[model samples]
Target: MTDKQTSPAVSVTLESGPAGTGSIDDFELFYARRALDRFRARLGRQGLLDLLAADIEEGNAFLRECARTSDGEFNAGTTVLQARGMTSAEFLAWMDAAFAGEDERPLLAAHPEHYAMGTDHIGARVVENIGPHVCSFYMGGWGTAAMAWAEDADELLPESEYPRKMSSNLFLEDGTVVGRALIQFGDTAEGFTANLTVYFPTSCPKGVLDHHLRHYAVEFRNWIVAAAEARA
Candidate 1:
């Protein structure tokens, strides 16, 4: 990825409206809400919730195996971000809220039209337009003890009594395993370090994989900043 950052272009056509009418920004806001509503409706029509419960169960098991074996059939990568003036606990508290759906604004605000539904600490269904593909996945995350993925036993931080670790697994609608993400945080004297690791099938194209890495960089950075701002 280039060091220079560029925002996505918006193509809005200005049209004259009646007196006291809303501005283009207002229309964009309305459209965004409508889009989310449509997405929610589509998921409802597909009976996704009923299937999601089962998918989460299977997906968790798949992720456990992946964590244990560190399978060669999957390609893995990590992105580390440092945040000053924030403790690891603080960052994790904000993250817990996000996962529980107490407040998703920070996550939704990270990107345009990012869709998420089903608010549970253990799982959520999300649809995101990442790179060349519009991807859908069932995401579930929890601490190492909850994960019960034995390999994590030796990975705990010595400095932390209850070290924060979020192991997230991604699965398709049909219960097909697609990817896994592990988010770990460690406290530093200055602040904390956030480590994000993603795993994808070996069959994934290099271009697609690279784009996802960049996507993680963009979204996570936005999320961390948003979290810090919220605390302020």
Candidate 2:
């Protein structure tokens, strides 16, 4: 990590859209350059599957609530999984083996409350990593999920040939409009960042959006910490 006294170790900035829109435009976060490099090194050696598994396990409770509230209808949005150890092909193979089998269960099976009994399979591309320095995964269960992986700073692009941002309209089973959620990934000179922007319709409650944001942040941080620790 960099010296906090001479240079700040970390910083967070929040910017919201025009009031009354019930939307978040930007939430910029920065991590120390050295620390980020260490995390990236660890991520590659440890692999994204392990980190993702840890993340889902840690956030099982919040995830359950989201699924239950949506009556089992939800979307995973865009999640970025960073790595370094293996090439894109190896990463995809590792992913297949990790979730392979006909009788697979949700990755959060440790928490019965969040476990959905059924075949939980994810389809991934092998030719290359989703963005630049990362591999992406799409998970299907309560609703669906899309994720990207970044192994280096170059992978995080505002726009890329591969799918960098994921968008979807969530709706209640009864046809009620829930809201729209957008997820994107990028990288700074020092670290990688994920942008999860959700826009709830005026009819939607703010509490719901708040919970989702909190949950996402918690899970992201948890994974990074877990990956860092494992690398150590």
Off by over 4 Å in 1: 1-72, 117-122, 141-162
What is candidate 1's local distance difference test score? 0.63
Tens digits of per-residue lDDT for model 1 on 1-232?
Answer: 5435887696666666546678878777778867765665566524543545555455444444443454435676777787788887877787668867655556665665354444543358775543455555777635434345414533333446325666766766555557777667787789888777776766655655677777777777777787798889
Per lDDT, the best of the predicted structures is 1
Count clashes in each candidate, considering only residues at least 3 apart in sequence or on different chains.
0, 10
* Root-mean-square deviation per candidate: 8.3, 16.4
Model 2 ranges off by over 4 Å: 1-157, 160-163, 171-177, 227-232
Task: Compute each candidate's TM-score over C-alphas.
Answer: 0.60, 0.34
Model 1 CA RMSD to the hidden true structure, in angstroms: 8.3
Poorest 10 consecutive residues by lDDT, candidate 1:
150-159
